[model samples]
Target: MTQDIWTLIVVILVFLGILALMIRGWRNRTRSQAGLFDSLPEVPAETGEVVLGPLTGVYIGSTVAGDWQARIARAPLGHRSAGTLTAFTGGLRLDLADATVWIPRSDLQTVRRASALANKTVPGGGILVARWQVDGPDGTTEIDSGFRADDKDTYPRWEALRGDAAPTTRPDTPSSTTEENK
Candidate 1:
C-alpha cells in the first residue's frame, strides 16, 4: 500500500511539472509576439536618417522606380527566405531564398538614416525603395522592398536580419574571389 502511494505521488509530481512547462512555453511565445509589435517607433514623414534594426531576413524582390519594376528572380534559400516580417496587416514569413537564413523577427531594435520618412507616398506608391542586398556564404541575394514608418510591426523582421548574432564585421580588404571578380 505504501509503495502504491509513493507511485501516485510521483505521477502527480510529473503531471504538475509538465503542466508548468506548458504554461511557461505559452507565456514565452506570447511575450515574443508582443515584443515584435511593441518594438517599432513611429516614423515621421520628414525623418531622413532612419536606422533599421537587424532584419529577420533580407528581402528577395526587385526594385521598381517609376515605370520599371523588379520581381524576385531566384531564391537560393528555397521558395522563401527563412525569416519573418510585418506586412501591411499582420506578420509574414520572408521566404525568398533556398538556404533559409533563420532570422528571428524579434531582433530588429532600431532604424536610423532612412530616406523613407520624408516620402509619405512611398509605402504603396512613389519611387521604389532602395534594393537591399546581402552576400552570404553561398552567393548574393537582393530584395526590392522599402522600409515603411507606419508599419512598425516589421521591426522584428529587421531585427532578425541585423541582430548582434549576424556576421562579424570584416576588414576593408577584399576577398580573393572579389579580387578575381574585379
Candidate 2:
C-alpha cells in the first residue's frame, strides 16, 4: 500500500509539472506572436552597416505587469529558446531558434544600458535595453529587448547604431578601487 501511494504521488507531481510547462509555453507564444503581422513591410539592411555579433545564447524575455519573465527555453516541455541578437545599420534583429524579430530604426524609440534582465541580475551595466514598437494584432505596441553583451567590445558600435552617445563610463565593469582591493 505504501509503495502504491508513493507511485501515485510521483505521478501527480509529474502531471503538475507538465501542466505548469504547458501554461508557460502558451503564455509565451501568445506574447511573442501577438505583434506578428503578415502584412507588415520589411526594410533592407543598408550597406556598410556594422554587424555587432550574432551575440549568441542570450536570454530573451518579455514584460508582464512591469516585470520581465523569460519567454521559454527550447528544451523539453518549454518553448523559450536561446536567441542571437544582431545590430546593423538600419536596426536590430533577434533570431530565435523558432522565430525571428526585426526592429527597424523607425520603430525604435530608445536604447539604454541596464544591469539586469528577466529575473537575473547582470553585474555592471552590461545589458543593452531597447524599447521599440511593433505591429501587433491590435495595432502598434511597445516591446523591450532584454539583452546582455557577451562581448563588451561590441557595445560602442551598438550604441552608435542606436544614435546614443558612447557612455562616458560603464558601471558593469569592476571599479579600479574594487580591483585594487581584491
Candidate 3:
C-alpha cells in the first residue's frame, strides 16, 4: 500500500519522539525533587532552628572530616541527634543533614538568599543563606557563614530581649559585636 503507509509514518514518528523524552524526564525529576523538598523550612524540633527565609537551602553537612564521624555514628543509633549543613549551590557542593540533601546533577545555581531574621524568644531562632563560590581541590572557598537559628545563646537572648531596639550602631565587620545589654 504506499510502502506500508511510509513505514507506519516513520514508526509513529519514532514513538512520539520517545514519548516526549520520557515525559520530559519525568517532569524534570518531579521538579527537582520539589525544589529540594521545598528548600527545607519549618525546622524547630525543640531547637533544630529554621525560623525563616532562604533558610534550608545551603547544605553540605560533610565532605571529608570523616563525614562528621559518620554522622556522629548514625546519631545515637538512629535515635536522631546529629547535625550537618554545608552549602554551595551552582558550582556544586551540598551535603545536608537530618537525612540527606545532596544535589549535583549539573548546571545548578539555585541557593540564593541574603537576609533573614528571627528571635522571638528563641524557641529555635532563625537566619538563612546559601550563597556560593567555591573551587575544589583546596583552592577557592568563599562561603559567608551565619546560620545560627537557635543555639549559641540565641544571640544573647535576642539582644537581651531587644532593649534599646537592638542596634547600637557598630558595623565595622569583625563579626560585629557591641552588645551593651540592650
Candidate 4:
C-alpha cells in the first residue's frame, strides 16, 4: 500500500511539472513576440447590424503578415477559439468567445484562401485568411488572421469582396447562405 501511494504521488508530480513547463513556455513565447502583437481596434457602434454573416467557425490563429511559421502569442489574438465572422461597413468583425476583434476595411490589405496557419492545417484552401494592418510595438505591422468557416462554400463569396481595396461601405452579399445577413 505504501509503495503504491508513493508511485501515484510521483506520477502526479510529473504531470504537474509538465503543466508548469507548458505555461512557462507560453509566457516566454508571448514575451518574445513583441512585434507580433498589437491592440485590436474597438468594433464600431453601428457594427451591431451584421451586413453579412456571423459565420460560425474556429479562429485558427494569426501570424506575422507573411510568415506562416511564426505564430502570434498575444492573448485572444494568439489563442484559438470557436469564432464567428461578420461583415460591416467599417470592416470584418471576428468574434471569438473570449473577445471581439475589429478589422477595419481601411486597414485591410487583402483576403485570401489558405491551407494552413501556425498551429492548424487544413485541405488546400480551407482557411479564409484576412490580411490587415495594425499598430504594433514596432509601428504598423501586417497580420494574417485565419478563420475556417463552418460552410466552406462561403469562402468564394468572401474572397470575392476584394478586401485588398476594401470598400468604404458594406458591400452587398453575393447571395445568401444558411447564415443570413444578421
Task: List clash counts for every candidate, in order.
Answer: 35, 5, 7, 0
Alpha-carbon deviation at 104 in model 4, angstroms? 0.5
Per residue, candidate 1 scores C-alpha lDDT tens digits across 9-49 of 99999999999998786566444333112221222233223
Instruction: Name the lDDT of candidate 3.
Output: 0.29
Residue pairs in steric clash, candidate 2?
Answer: 72-80, 73-80, 74-80, 124-172, 125-172
| Superposed model 2: Cα runs more than 4 Å off | 7-11, 14-48, 64-80, 137-139, 163-182
- Please provide, for model 4 over 64-103, each residue's C-alpha lDDT reduced to its tens digit, 9 standing for 90 to 100: 6556656788877888899999887678999899899888
Of 3 and 4, the candidate ahead on lDDT is: 4
Looking at model 3, residue 73 earns an lDDT score of 14
Which candidate's lDDT is highest?
4
| Model 4 global lDDT (CA atoms, 0 to 1) | 0.75
The global C-alpha lDDT for each of the candidates, from Candidate 1 onward, is 0.33, 0.55, 0.29, 0.75
Candidate 3 residue spans exceeding 4 A from truth: 1-82, 87-97, 105-107, 117-126, 131-182
TM-scores of the models, in the order given:
0.22, 0.59, 0.20, 0.79
Clashing pairs in 4: none
* TM-score winner, 1 or 4: 4
Candidate 4 ranges beyond 4 A from true positions: 1-8, 34-38, 48-51, 164-182
For each candidate in turn, give its C-alpha RMSD to the true structure in angstroms: 17.8, 9.1, 17.2, 9.0
